[model samples]
Target: MPYASLSEYNFFEGELKNLQPVYKVIPYDINSSLFTDYAIKKRFIWMPKDVQANYTTDREVPVFPIGTVLIKNFYYDNTIPNNTTYIIETRLMIKKADGWAFANYVWNDEQTEALLSTQRETIRMSWNQNGTAITTNYKTPSTIDCATCHTINNVYTPIGVKPQNLNKMYTYNDGTKNQLSKWIEEDYLDTKPTTINSTVDWADASQSLELRVRSYLDINCAHCHSTGTSCDYTPMELSFSQSTVPENLGICREPIDFVTGDQQYIVSGQDIQGSLMHFRMNTNIQSEMMPPVGRTIVHQEGVELIEEWINSVETTCP
Candidate 1:
């Protein structure tokens, strides 16, 4: 069943129930098509080598034509230029439904290079129009959006993916525990290893969770947490740097987590979990998860770091 029984005894669907989404992304393996998901996985990514070819990664679901208004976020996934990862959270059933609907919504796919193509056309026209137009002024979607999204998130997420738990402290695959590195060294993965400093213009801000976390919260959490929006079940009403620790203050927010020891998915807060973070990450999908737009997965390592950072909240603003 989509949503059997929440702590509230029933799920609550949000106003996002009317939209549907399709995805295209860069992939990891050069041998498959990224957009090959004709069967429609609940949550999955496009193959790096070919969007037309269908390839499935571990824990990736195969479902498409997600008929609902989902919160879609995009990324480049330089790790495998072929397919980028889009963190699409779904708010459709967060307010109106009675039980589990989906883990919000998220996945990986490509964008037909249309943005890149459009930029090229714009540049060509500029050249013909002025021949002396600032050649550097012409920008690509990857640049305009990538720099903003990545930098907006503290530039930690290259293509919207920060090497969460990266052991080397600066590199994703360099960590002794990073098994993914060995694959890259062996050329088994299309993604190349990335060093912490490898990111462009990262660390411009102080190396505090405030800066890093604030940036991420802005891009990831602020959409619904903002005023006038009915995102979370109880309406956490949070914004980046709004307080020294918005996410920390967000602890025990309802429809996200309820330490009252009573399950009420319909009302705010459910289960006796610590907060939405604990609940969202602890459980799998189709249940108490977040982004309330995309899938449930929580970006594994990314959440782990944010959780670690959140647990050690400081009064200083980020």
Candidate 2:
């Protein structure tokens, strides 16, 4: 659907394979090795001869609109036959035309397991020609999240760690999928938030959440939140995925955070207590935000979801 194989569809070394209709991919995520991803530590070695030509040079078109194609028909349930709940991220970073792979993780039925099982998201890349209205190559993705990944760019930037409105594709949460703008589209009261929980087979997700969440936290917040880093002493080592972190996104790591007493940086459960998530969401000058470095303002829904999830955590984290 989205990729020729599973990971990236490499065309850098060889010829363009299946070039989807220009419109198939949204306008903004057109990052073709041209822009500088400040977070990228290693510069890519291979480059296509006509990297720029791939797009339609017309001014109004943004990028050229050759044709149209539908990679993933998210509309249809079970289009993804696997009983495993999917944690798919729209990773657009393609490596050497040939060096493309992805991770397709599997969650449990009803999707309530340890996190390790879903440590990896389902990732895929390809090298197919963009032809007609639809293609089935999407079924056999090569790899998972291993090949494709996020750079250190700020959240709001094109090359940020957090998933932005990339590829202009539908935004993916655990249960629902929709266009980012669609959330506010039409009447706000139109379609209420749907309850779309995932369904995995069994209890295999424990390790998935543990390892994957750790890996994610390592790549994402770990850079600055680790020992000796900005958040010294306080060891969150928190993770998110198929697994369940005790406080979820709580600022349990910091005792006095945004709180009145002891003078810590955040409070675990209280959003108003200046929890790390809350502070990160704050753009006001009066608020002492974190990362004060890269990343854009935190996603409001993400913050609220984390807060709600924290409230849902059992007193004991199994």
Candidate with top lDDT is: 1
TM-scores for all candidates: the values are 0.32, 0.29
Give the residue spans of candidate 1 off by over 4 A: 1-206, 232-235, 245-248, 252-273, 314-318
Q: Across residues 204-288, which tens digit of lDDT does each residue of candidate 2 receive?
A: 3443333433333333454344333445344453322312454433335544344223424343443343345454544423245
Task: Please give the lDDT score at residue 275 for candidate 1.
Answer: 40
In each prediction, how many residue pairs overlap at the backbone (N, C-alpha, C within less than 3 A)?
68, 58
* lDDT, model 1, position 32: 11
**How high is the CA lDDT of each candidate model?**
0.30, 0.29
Model 2 residue 167 CA deviation in Å: 22
> Residue by residue across 1-318, what tens digits does model 1's lDDT show?
223212121122232221222232111211111111011112112222221211122211111112211122222221222232322221122111331122222221232111112111111111121222211122123223322322322221222122221112222223433423533443323342353221111123455555565545544554445443344344454443353444333543335444433433221222223345445544545445455433323444446545665557442321
Q: Alpha-carbon error at 156 in model 2, in Å?
A: 23
